[model samples]
Target: KLSKRYDCVVMEDLNMKGMSQALNFGKSVADNAWGMFTTFLRYKLEEQGKRLIKIDKWFPSSKTCSCCGQVKAELSLSERTFQCECGFTADRDHNASINIKREGLRLLA
Candidate 1:
């Protein structure tokens, strides 16, 4: 249903180190499937005549505010949530995902 509605998918160049570090050993084993998921998603998207836009590694998707486009002074790995002065609030990961998607769209345009 979602695929039928959306024309494209976008993702960020995820920080493997951060992801790995955040997981417990047992969870890390499970998280190993992430790469496989990404590969499968890419092929599946192509088969559906859809494109995946991947944002660059250097793009500051996490630090940059998606709402007001303000840059935060600091954010740490321990921070699992984002609270911007502009009143933008989101889970840290979700915020990064949104920012990366925005950046990807900009790059595509």
Candidate 2:
């Protein structure tokens, strides 16, 4: 349904194995079946003649200020809000989503 509805799908090219090994929630990550899900999504998109754009995993989507394009040197996961030095503040996930959307659109262009 998603493949037929959307012309393109954007996703982060995450290093799942490395993440699972580095984080404490290895078992939980493995159980999520992210790899399998991405595989299925890719095939489904291909079948519907849609494209999947995967942004670089290393891109600092969470740490960068969505408004000013300022990249922070450090941003802990505990910080739920993104506070930029330029006086722009927003919810961390919302800011990251904006960055992701911008990157995805850039790739499409």
Candidate 3:
């Protein structure tokens, strides 16, 4: 689905293996098959002139509220959910995905 809908993919530069040290956090992240997905996207996109963009690990995509554009002062790794001061609530990964998509688009344009 992601491949069909999007021309390119963008991801965070996370140390996925290190992330697994946390209880549920590490396991779930590893389960996402991010490395495999990125590899697949890279080869696939290259065939079509598309590409993948990688944002920095410290990009603050998760802590920055997409709606209000405010960067939270405190966002811990233990927090799997994002609670924005602006009342925007979203899953941590989802929120980061949104930010990544936005930033990736800006970079492409």
Candidate 4:
């Protein structure tokens, strides 16, 4: 359904193994089959003639403010909310998603 709605989809190239270990997901990480899911999604999107664009893992999407384009030097993972000096406050994940969208669009351009 989502693949048909959007011609292009963007995703960040993440370090899944490290993340799973660091986040202590236990058996859940392996059980979830994220890799398999991604593969399935890729095939499904391809079948629909849609695109899946993967941005670099090193891109600081989480640390960058979506509204002001300010990049913070350090943003700890413990900080769930992102508060920028430019008066932009948003959930960390939400801000990252916005930055990811912008970066993906830039890549397309």
TM-scores for all predictions: 0.72, 0.92, 0.73, 0.91
lDDT of each: 0.78, 0.91, 0.83, 0.89
Give stretches of model 1 more than 4 Å off: 1-5, 15-31
Across residues 1-109, which tens digit of lDDT does each residue of candidate 2 receive?
Answer: 7788899888889888788888777777777889898899989999888888898999899999999999999999999999999999999999998998899999899
Worst 10 residues of 3 by lDDT: 18-27
**Pairing residues by index, what is the TM-score of model 3?**
0.73
Model 2 steric clash pairs: none
lDDT score for residue 75 of model 4 = 96
Candidate 4 deviant stretches above 4 angstroms: none
Ranking of all predicted structures according to lDDT, beginning with the best and ending with the worst: 2, 4, 3, 1
Candidate 1 lowest-lDDT run of ten? 21-30
How far in Å is the alpha carbon of 86 misplaced in model 1? 3.4
Candidate 4's residue-wise lDDT over 16-107, tens digit each? 77777889977777677778877877888899998888889999999999999989999999999999999999999999999999999999
Please provide the root mean square deviation of candidate 4 (C-alpha atoms, Å): 1.3
The TM-score leader among the candidates is 2
lDDT of 1 at 17: 56
